[model samples]
Target: MNLNLRAAILHNVSDNDQSQLEDTIVDAIQSGEEKMLPGLGVLFEVIWKNSSEDEKKEMLETLEKGVKG
Candidate 1:
């Protein structure tokens, strides 16, 4: 939706230890397990706390669109 919410989601999604978190998200979407989306917020927070500015911006844009619609 808005930039702040998008940034938040990106922050959570980027927190996962696994490099495949993005893939996992895609799989979840394909499987229709939409409930798992909330966990992305946690991952986003983790990532947001530790990420570089460039990475944060990219992820923010991507997750914002994903979460918003």
Candidate 2:
């Protein structure tokens, strides 16, 4: 996960307007594509990096519920 590569991927996602990226994410999750999980990890990493501690705590709580459900 090079920062430069991650930035490039994020830039590409942003430039493409995220619709396709959303679809890909949905497909990956629904299809249980384990490999695609890393992409999600990257996304979470980006968000977590920029988020406040409270936001991160809330996100983690939400994720825990999602995982349980």
Model 2 lDDT per residue over 1-69, tens place: 346756655775675446887786787789897777777777778779999999999998998999999
lDDT (C-alpha, whole model) for all candidates: 0.71, 0.77
TM-score of each: 0.42, 0.62
Q: Considering summed lDDT, which 10 consecutive residues are worst modelled in model 2?
A: 1-10
Which residue pairs clash in candidate 1?
11-44, 11-45, 12-43, 12-44, 12-45, 13-43, 13-44
Candidate 1 at 18: error in angstroms?
Answer: 2.9
Predicted structure with the largest lDDT when compared to the true one:
2
Off by over 4 Å in 2: 1-14
Q: Specify the poorest-scoring 10-residue window by lDDT in model 1.
A: 1-10
Work out candidate 1's RMSD over C-alphas.
8.9
Number of the top-ranking candidate, with TM-score as the measure:
2
